[model samples]
Target: MGYKQRISLLMLIDSLIVLVSVVFSYWLLSPTLYLAPAVVGISSVTLFIGHHIFAHVFKLYKRVWQYASINELLSITTAVSLSIMTLAFVQLLSFQTVYSRTLLVTWMLHILLIGASRFSWRLYRDTKMQSDKNKKRTLIIGAGNGGTLVARQLLNSGTSELYPVAFVDDDVTKRDLTIMGIQVIGNTKDIEKVVVEKNIEHIIIAIPSLIKCELNDIFSKCAVTKVKTQIMPSVEDIMSGRVSVNAIRDVQVEDLLGRAPVKLDNKKIADYLTGKTILVTGAGGSIGSEVCRQVAKFHPKAIILLGHGENSIYSIDMELSTITDGIVIKPEIADVQDKQRIQTLIEKYEPDVVYHAAAHKHVPLMEKNPHEAVKNNVIGTKNVAEAADEAGVTAFVMVSTDKAVNPTSVMGATKRIAEMLVQHMDMISETKFVAVRFGNVLGSRGSVIPLFKKQIEAGGPITVTHPDMTRYFMTIPEASRLVIQAGAIAKGGETFVLDMGEPVKIVDLAKNLIRLSGLTEEDIPIQFTGMRPGEKLFEELLSENEVHSEQIYPMIYRGKTPPVNVNVLYDLIEKSHHLDKGELKDLVLDIAHFKTKYLTQLSLVE
Candidate 1:
């Protein structure tokens, strides 16, 4: 039946019960003397009207019958009290004391009976709903606040597909106890057994503050179970007051790395990018595209995407256009090495900030064609920095690598030269030129994560360069965010390096990837392919001679390198430009030794 019809029926039944109780009380109080039928009927009608009016005003009918709580009980009490008061006032005014004051006491008992009856029906209906045949048996991994909140939401929501069967918590004291009607089964160690016993279809990890390492361990344990698993978003996400079911996304590659999230100063970052015209060179590349995405959040006045690849550039442009509503994003096809084209574009756009991410980054490829590395990584950077200076850009940031700290690969040497070029240019230019350097970005194109994933998916024999090889890793988005923040804090001639957490051994990384994919070491074999040309066993973010200090941002560090004579450096680069490939290699080799002691240490590590 409809709610209105049901409420009307309840009201009628309650009124009849109240009338009967009142008549009985009158009989007991004064059996020898009886009131006129007319007076009794009038009094009954008056009481019913008073009760109905007070209940309606109190919104008693609006309460959800099945989910009634203490709040609803309070409302019922107020409605009943007002009804009794109205009836007493009416009796006193009419001088109807002949009816006896004992009827008023009976009316109070009637209110309690009616209210209890209504609440009892609601409780019975809810219990039946919970025990319905179609309810999904689910397990909650934590019995903390977040878990309790999730359980409450599920219970209150009648249309939800999930039912809380039990909870799994680490606290021994909580075991075998019940919370919000759901029992605590055991700790996470017992998840498999609990899932099997309870026929659980889903498991929810409700600990938002869990570290990645703990999450990885939990995920490993849960991966074997048939139940689908989900996690609560991080505490920061919840604290921001943006919590929702949709925010709880599937576990990603980043989660397996066990790296902590990067922290930033929003005020400083916003102040740097807001309303400024920003340009990202190589905007279509993995790191470059992420930088574009991060910068767009700051509501830049305009963002110019400078890249040579049309398809990559077009894809990033479309992606950014869809995401950025108020910002203007202009994609231009131009090679950074072409000084004339880069100069023209910069002069036209007059970008307040420029992120020079255009370079040949692949180590083996650069090693095979060393001159090309010089052309793109070294010369291209010089061209862009010069153009930014000529156009009077406020800041120019060069996206560099940890390899640049020491020279090993042609790619590394070229990048180091790029940093030197920028440092030298900063001495002459009014624009603030800075280099932001870091190690590998996880899940980027051609990165170890994707390579490992492909190998695992292809079945057996995941290849690693060497068993001893290790490299620092960070999420693409985190690295990109740090780059933008670094730009905001850049003064002339400073190198901002990211504190990429502990370096991960490549061999161990492969094994972990295999395990994360639900494969055993015996099932998925790891093969060590000899190291690639120009590849090093380890990478460093700073040279031994370089002085470093903490930045305002926790993950970012500023390094002070010895000043180079710009005039002499330019002359040397010009000389190398005229040399043959063989001579150039020799010149690069000579320059490599003079660079830093980190290079020799890297060689030893290799």
Candidate 2:
């Protein structure tokens, strides 16, 4: 409705209600007495004027009544009460007497009629909008502000297909309350019962500020109903205009697996990264690209995108170019394994900070091709670290893995050797060298989540390595941001382990992914394959000897794993080519585990 028309319609209805209320009170209270026309006319006019004046003062007509609540009711009551008081005062001044009984009755009637008239629009809207039976019956989990916001949007939205049927809150005080005509049916514990009783087809976790544990608890309740569940967009996103209030998103496996990300100290990051040239090897890979994205936000002097693959480097370079202007983004198609090429780029760009993310990470693939792991993970790290040292880089951050701890696989041992290589470099080189170690990245290229999704899409048995195999998981962004944060606070030779919260079983992860895909175990069954040759039953972030008691930053811990003997590390790099896969694996594992024992064991000597 037009603003002026709406205001006019409300004013006319209010005028009629006022006149009727005044007349009814006068007839009922003083039928035997002489009902003076002057008294009724004066009472009605003064009351009407007082109501309108107060309505303007309270912004009564400005409020959208269809989404009204107690606040609106309070406004109506105050406006009506003030008008009645104004009438009583006018009567005393004009006639030297006040009709207390008649006036009291009139005030009661006026409040009732005025409140009903305003709330009736809401009633009509709810009835008209909710009459559509095709909309999905949605149960909202919170009854607080976030819950009401979702409900109000659903009620007013012609575009949305969700129809909020009821609310369920854990707070007992909010029970039995009606918001926007939707009742608070029960607590979260009653989600299944309420879903069955109300025929709820969908559920929304409407509490935006819920912690990880709380959200998981609420979702566990909703999951029991086997209903498709989603969470409302966060209040920060809504306030920032990045998304609408109703732009709710589905719950993903990452939400349940990891704890809250550490808050970065921006000033600390900016001091090291802002306007300083950064060279990120494997810049096109998952963690590498994300590091570039996060680094760009710090406004680096220039970003050198170094990677082996041409397309991945090109893709990330173009993406960075579009998001930012005036900052130089240089893409170099050079393999980190090629020492000469790496040194050439390092000399050309002279990046202040270098993030060495290039690695051969797949456990099974690296196990079969241990030589590749040696070339890319161990030797590649040496190439970059040496080049950075030669170029006088300020900080060199090498990306390591949780598998590097107490290594069992060729991949893990090679990465462990790489970690030791960097720490050894930190001892002699002027550059501050550190390794940021993390476990499985949830959605990285070739990560388990994508593989499970593909298997689910293919409508087959989703294969898990083992029923008991567990690993720490973090989102790519969390891993990348912490990697950058670690570089900011680098003291030489330290291994920064990102706090991954807890380890999740592979079977549990598969089951959650399947259920979140809106499928039950019957629809898509899970199969347990034997663990891979290089895989661990469970991965550890740090070995027993490397455990620390305190955190350097939130969600980041200092792991002081002493470096391997530099001679054995050099021996692995030199003898890796001549040794077969089995011999290579044994040598790398030996070097990774027993750092000093390699000198006594001369079996790997050429």
Candidate 3:
């Protein structure tokens, strides 16, 4: 039937119910008195009119009982209560006798009949929705509020393909209890058993507040069952109402890092970035692109994206263009090693701050080609810092790595030289020059995590340099945010070290990745090769004698390095330009203070 026709039919049924309730109440209250037909007729008419009028006013007939929720239930209560009140008042005025007891009985019966009719359709719809043949039997990991929400949504979502069969919560009190008709079979340890018993094809992790260790353990158990696994967003995200419990997603490597999200000081960042024209050297790189994103939030006047790679530069430029309102984004394709190009651009733009991030960072690649590393990391940094100094920029921050401490590889040596150059420039230049040093970024272009994922995808043994190797790790945004925070507190010639929580073992990382991908170590073996050339067992964040003091920012610390003579560095830079591969390695090692053993090893390589 059409909408209007259906509503009219409902109204007719409700009017009949009103008449029957009032007559039954009158007979029960005064059975000895012969009821007058006119009195019964008038009272029934009064009740039928009152009930229908209130019901129509509340739009009660417009609701589809098959999809009814609490709102609809409330509407039924309101319509019934209001109608009873109107009938009781009308009977006292129009009739000689008042039937208070009968009216009370009628009110209770009317509510029960109305509520049952509406909810019966709801029950049918839920049962029909869950009975789909294509629905996948699902298991939920959490049995608290988060799990309840997911279960309620899946059961009521008519088109959903998942049917929650069981819940696995660690709370003992809820061991044998049921939620939304789903049983709480066991804790995370019984995940495999539950999956086997229920023939569950999918598992949803509804514990948004789970710690990394607990999540890792639960994920390992799910992998053993060989079932598809998905996780909810973080607790903060869910609590903020930005995402729903039903919005599940595939688990990522970042989720397994076991590190909390870095909290940034917006006032500090905005104080330095507001109304300033900023220049990011490696704007296309992972760190550089994130820097642009964070900087744009401060409402900068203009930003210059300078990099040699056109594709990466273009990508960042387009992305910023969509979100930026008044910020002028200028993408310049220029190599940082070209001193004249950098100097000329700085002269033209006159940027308020210069973030020099361009450098060749791969250890093995730099070991084979030391000349390129020197030219890019050392010379390129010198070119940018000097240009900023000459241009009279407000502040200059250079990105440095943990490997620069007590260097053992060509990459580490080059980055250390870059840090020293920044320190020396701060002594004489008007521009405040500083360097922010940290360890490995999680998902950069050529990071190890992505490499392991690819190896797992190929269904073969994943390669690891050493079984015991470890490195400090942080997210790309965390590193970028600290870089900006470093610039805000820059005085001159200080190396800022970010507080990376702990070093993660490479083998453990590999094993976790295998599990996250729904496979076990036995499925994809991990091969341990001996350490590669220029690779270290562990990375250091500070030199032996480098003194550090706490800074105003919570995560950043300042390190004082041994002073270097600028004129000597300039002479070294000039002389190295003429040196060949063998000569260049020697100069770089000596200048960066590499250990005798490493230098001897490199010398023996060729």
Best prediction by lDDT: 2
Model 3 pairs in collision:
none
Work out how many backbone clashes candidate 2 has: 0
In terms of lDDT, the poorest run of 10 residues in model 3 is 597-606
Superior candidate under lDDT, 1 versus 2? 2
Candidate 1 lDDT (Cα, 0 to 1): 0.80
**Model 2, which residues run further than 4 Å from truth?**
22-53, 84-105, 155-159, 172-186, 233-247, 258-260, 297-301, 318-330, 549-555, 562-568, 571-590, 593-597, 601-606
Best by TM-score: 3
How far is each candidate from the true structure, as Cα RMSD in Å? 5.1, 3.9, 4.3
Q: Considering lDDT, which of the candidate structures 2 and 3 is the better prediction for this target? A: 2
Output the worst ten-in-a-row residue range by lDDT, candidate 2.
597-606
> Candidate 3: where is the Cα deviation over 4 Å?
1-40, 56-71, 170-179, 183-199, 211-214, 236-246, 547-552, 594-606
Top-down TM-score ranking: 3, 2, 1
Model 1: pairs clashing at backbone N, Cα or C within 3 Å: none
Please report how far candidate 3 places residue 422 from its true position, in Å.
0.7
Q: Give the per-residue lDDT of model 2 (tens digit) for 1-606.
A: 799999999889888999999899989998743368888889889998998999899998799887677899999999888888899999999999999999899989998998898888888877876787789999999999999988888888877889999999999999999987799989988999999999999999999877776777787777778899999876555765778877789998877764876678899999999899999999999999999998998898999999889999999998999998778999999988899999989999889999999998998898899999999998899889999999999999999999899989999999988887888889889999999999889899989899999999999699987889998898898899889999889989999998888788889888888878888889999888888798889888988889897988888899887545576568557977999988888889988887456745422422
In lDDT terms, how accurate is model 2? 0.88
TM-score of every prediction relative to native: 0.82, 0.86, 0.89
Q: Decide which is better by TM-score, 1 or 3.
A: 3
